[model samples]
Target: MDNKEYKEYTAADFLNDPDFLLWCLDPDKREDLFWSEFPANHPETFAEFRKAIQTVGSVRLNNFTLEEGEKAELYDSIMSDYRALCSRRRLLRRRLFALAAAAVVAAGVVVPALLGVFRPPTETDASPARASEIRLISGRQSEHIASESASIECAPSGEVRINGRKIASAKPARMNRLVVPEGKRADITLSDGSRVWINSGSVFTFPAAFGEGERRVSIEGELYIDVTPDPERPFIVHNALFDTRVLGTSFDVNAYCDSNRPASVVLVHGAVEITTGDGEQVQLESNDMFSLKAGNYTVVKVDPSQYVSWKDGLFTFSSGTLERVIAQIAAYYRVEIVCDPDVRELCCSGKLVLFDDLSDTLDVLSDILPINCRIEQRPDGTRAVCVTARTN
Candidate 1:
């Protein structure tokens, strides 16, 4: 099916599609691409598409030739459960929105695709080449690191090494920038033993070693940091919009400058003081989530573990928006994902176990939400995934 026709498919439609069923049973790269791309293109039915895929996968119909009556019965049973689950979901959503709006305000896009019309190239159609790359810049020397992850370790001799190369000496201080692009992540331990876990699509810059009186690092995108206990010297996290200072604490900072996505600081433990560019300040104790968007800051109580779970490859979303979930998946997998504005606010609550394969994660997402996913390759050799509302 073409993108437009596929956009009209519902969960029942996908489940009844013979080609879709066979692809689910034994998929090739082409089939994989189509399925992965479907959810990104049709997020309104993204959750349902996932359910259909899962139902097909779980059913062992290929074992034997079934009679027409038997086939009908099996299909009926599956649909019954699917409908019940969807019903429960609708009810659950009502309860979740009441409680989660203040705590986990799900956030992220626009517009309609005219049938049979070719969309002229726009900014969104650009190749997602940066998704698969990571860049490191030290002084005037810049290099591309080819790995899914990067790590910096402090030697027993007080030397700071990145990916096993000693990047800094003991006495003096030097600044280094580490940019983990959309499809990768990194971990860095400073000379002072403070460790930072950088998420995908993030940029982190820190000094080689700690100097007297203070430690500071600036980041764009997302990071989970564990600041070593040093009562005399405080650690400060700097971003374009704000700065967070702490004595000895663990916190997560997500400050992506690409879009209006709010810069947020979620404290896992200890205490922090956040100061915005405009000098507005907010103090957060343990388990406080502070978000700043459009120069306004809001604080809410939340379970810090849910916010920082990405560091462990476990994504926990409690009534989170589909837009945010898709964005996280896109960054984690280094794929381009576009969601229709219509379905961006669809709330989903679930825990996803991430695998190295992007398709596997999408499958989990599809199973959790009524969404379809598909992959499309651009002329520039980069792949993009489009998500939209599934057709009735």
Candidate 2:
């Protein structure tokens, strides 16, 4: 294919391309170099290319043996089915290709049960459900705070207070969990004087007081933390994929544990050393962002404000695609947002103040971009914001 043709290819087009299939099936050094450089050369098609790669990589062919002739026959059959399906419907082509790819090289009969293509979307696949209130859990006791935003304090004496009212008193070493539901935010002052601003849909676990050894906390969503500088006791933040260690510095950690999103750490100041699940350690300086995707780590320089601004009820982006911006809004408000694929890749730049009302924020976004936003009810009994190209 020519450069223009390759640049215009969608995920489905890439999956059905003979050259792409050859590279996936029988990779050579030349093809590896070419595919690796394709994204850099055609930035517009990078997302589609990445989607194709992930779809292909996730298919697992198990322990089925087939004769050479059988393999050839099965491959031809799968390709024929794929082509027939492609000609019928464009919306279902990717899912059909996934099933075809699974049985193409395998000798056994195609089994739809073994493929993930037919699986329904799980809870993680959708926007997190909005909880009625934030819950703080300590041992068997749970405290529910009904406020839109909450401020919790943990005193050195093992006393916990929410919004200046004493909630619970426990041992200094007792572990406590704070849950911030969607459409809300919270700030917590740890016993050691370190403060953390937790974002929506986040779960933060920390001890009521720091031990003599090291201060440690674990988070599943996102948070902006300012560590109390104590060289003797380094502060560490743990997530599913990696651990970030620092001393007396501020940084933003976005470890949402979502397959579609990469876990990243953005350093606002000071420095941090990240230890991956495989024990690979990387150090980051100020204004540096470290992102981990598919077991690989990448570091880049970015404006710290673009990431940490959420702590101040602001969303900032520069040349960010509409798809990503909508994803962020969906997570923040716990609202399902569906952006038209035709306009998903459109890029915009601006700062948006996240108002309490989601519509207010959407209004600002619609004004900034050439898009129209409307709320619609999905078949699943939930409401969603649908974004399409502006007609007027």
Best by TM-score: 2
Cα error of candidate 1 at position 242, Å: 1.1
Candidate 1 lDDT by residue in tens digits, 1-392: 55346544544456445456546654568878987787787787777688766644433211235689989986996587567657685433432322222222222234343311112112221122344566666677666666455666754344666565565444336677777765456788877888899887677887766778688899877899999999889999998889999999999998765453567999998999998898877899999999988778899999987788777555677767776677677656656677666667777655554545576556545443445767788998767777656563
State the C-alpha lDDT per candidate.
Answer: 0.66, 0.74
Native-structure RMSD, model 2: 19.4
lDDT of 2 by residue, 294-350 (tens): 999899999998798787666766667666678788877767776666566666455
| TM-scores for every candidate against the unseen true structure | 0.62, 0.66
- Clashing residue pairs, backbone N/CA/C < 3 A, model 2: none
Q: How close is candidate 2 to the true structure, as a TM-score?
A: 0.66
